[model samples]
Target: MEMKIGSKSNKIKYYFLVPALTVLIFMTIVPLIFSLGVSFTNYSPTRIGSWSFIGFENFIRTFTDSEIGTSFINNVIFVVVSVTIEFVLGMVIALLLNRKIRGISFIRTMFLLPMMVTPVAVGLMWRWLLNTDYGLLNYFIEQVFGITSINWLGSYSLAMPSIILVDIWKWTPFMILSLLAGLQSLSQEPIEAARIDGASNWQIFRYVTLPRLKNIIFVILLIRTIDCLTRSFDVVWTLTNGGPGLSTELLSLRIYRLAFKFWETGYASAVSWLYLLLVIFITTRFISYLYKQEF
Candidate 1:
């Protein structure tokens, strides 16, 4: 009777888990398999019913294609520059807010408002603000510095910087929130010990606080890098549509154009797979760092 009851309980538990497992497999695994299969084929809208297995040709083209290469370079720059700025700015803001001050709660809430705004909305808002003719930004610049209107999104030299600036504005709050949480949760004992040892404020931060927060910092970096690399589409699409002659064409945007605009489905899938591999490689490195820090 005891053995029978244990078997019954195990069966009941498996029944409860089956639906969720099935859903995961259907939703994620199936699509991934389908896309992987498509990546090797010569699939496109133009080839309506006729398609053939091209097997690595698309993959080869992805690496050799100059446009894709440029876009990948742009993506690297975007990840490094934007993440660095956000981390620094967010860290400083987090440090400042960690202090006891009047209206601290209100200020912290206000700082998060930008992140709360939808990416598309943020892009549109910045678009109007940065417009050349009657934009508020150019208007202020002219009033303050006697400079003429600047073409922010139209100029090749300025367009990428403009996109980076907008990204920094929208995402810095996320870094602040993550780092602030890490800062608050840190044990005060180490900090106190450092202070007791005649360590200056900078010395305490460099030696004690930073080391303690390393794991949290790595986690934040991993999350932000993945998010920024994968989901940079919406805002950038809204702002420039990879615009002004592909000046700001990120890898994600480039994929969008290949898949949707050019209708090069198979090639796009190949490029996407390569891009996915790149992200997985970088994320794996960060996870290794995290594990090292843990041990």
Candidate 2:
């Protein structure tokens, strides 16, 4: 009788999972499989019923297209420059915050406000501040430094850098919070022993704190890199719409333009699949290196 009751309870639990599994298959699995099929066809939404398979033509074009190449190059530059700055600045801020200063909690909260704001809102707020005329930033520059108003978003040379700046501002807080948590969780015995050995602050950090924080650092880097690659659409779209002659276009924006603006759904699907593969490849490498370091 006890066995029968236990079996019935297990069956009841399985029945409860049925709805969730059904939703997952329909919402995620089905769409993914459908899109994979669409990527091999010439299925322009504008053409509706008159679409057919074109083998690997779309994938071939993705490799040879100059515009895609340019967008990819721009993305690489953005990721490298922005992530580097964020890591450095975040480490500094995290170190400072780890100290037992007065009002440290309040300061940490204030530092995180920029990250809590929505990306589109950050873009819009910065857009106004970066305006050439009568903008707050320009006003301050003119008053404090005697510099003329500069067109931040309108220039080809400055457009990509401006986008990077916005990204850094919005994301550096994540690094700070993540690193701070790692620091707080670390066992204090090693750090205390390092101090007893007459090690300087820099030496203690270099020898003790950093090595322990490696796993957290790797995790945050992977998360941020994937985010910058795929989900930076709102901020970039709002800031410049890939303007200044595609100077600030990312792969996400490129896919958007191809799919919606140009109505080349099949080509867009192919590019998106390639983009997904690139992300997966990078993530796999990151995990592999992390495990190697651990072992």
Candidate closest to the true structure, highest TM-score: 1
* TM-score (all chains, Cα) for each model: 0.95, 0.94
What is the per-residue lDDT of model 2 for residues 122-195, given as tens digits with 9 covering 90 to 100?
98998998888867988999999999978889999989989999999999999999999999999999999989
Clashing pairs in 2: none
Give candidate 2 misplaced runs (Cα > 4 Å).
1-12
The local distance difference test score of each candidate is 0.90, 0.91
Residue 244 lDDT, candidate 2, scale 0-100: 86
Worst 10 residues of 1 by lDDT: 286-295
